[model samples]
Target: MPLVNIDIIEGVFSAEQKQIMIKKVTDTMVSIEGENLRGVTWVKINEVKQGDWGIGGQTLTANDVKAMAQG
Candidate 1:
């Protein structure tokens, strides 16, 4: 079985987007590992608190992420 874990700051993605991510990841794994593993493939998404995630040496907030996306 193949296990995939994705971590992102909370509120960065909507429910539908996350669902798409899960499906796409599973499909990719199936394509690479063969159809038989489809039933055994696992994908997990973890959402961390905004301030708990950081970049460089600074802690990041939701607003910080939004600004980064705009630039």
Candidate 2:
């Protein structure tokens, strides 16, 4: 049985992106494990508080990461 847990900051991905992610993850597991595909499950999607997630001592939201990457 292959189980996947994906965690991310809130408001980052749209519905279509999430669906594609699920499909890709499941397909990869199926390809690698064959019959084990039946046992594969996407556990949960968690939205963490911005203040709870940090890098270099500063809390970061999803937008912050995007902004940083653009610069």
Candidate 3:
């Protein structure tokens, strides 16, 4: 069994986006681990509250990420 944990700031992704991410992650794992492990593969998506996550010593939020992406 393979357990994958992904953490991101809350509100950065929509429900559909999250689903796509999950699917892609599972597919990637299946590709590497083979079909048998698909049944036991686990993917966890953790969303941290805005301002609660920090990077480079600065607290970041969803909007900050969006702005960074656009620039």
* Top candidate (TM-score): 3
- TM-score of each predicted structure versus truth: 0.88, 0.74, 0.95
Error (Å) of candidate 3 at residue 44 is 0.5
Residue range 12-56, candidate 3, lDDT tens digits: 999999999999999999999999999999999999999999998
lDDT of each: 0.91, 0.74, 0.96
Ranking by TM-score: 3, 1, 2
TM-score of 3: 0.95
The global Cα lDDT (0 to 1) of model 3 is 0.96
Itemize residue pairs with steric clashes in candidate 1.
none
Per-candidate RMSD, Å: 1.3, 2.2, 0.7
Report how far residue 20 has shifted in candidate 3, in Å.
0.6
Q: In angstroms, give how far residue 30 of model 1 lies from its true place.
A: 1.0
Give the C-alpha miss distance for residue 48 in model 2, angstroms.
Answer: 1.3
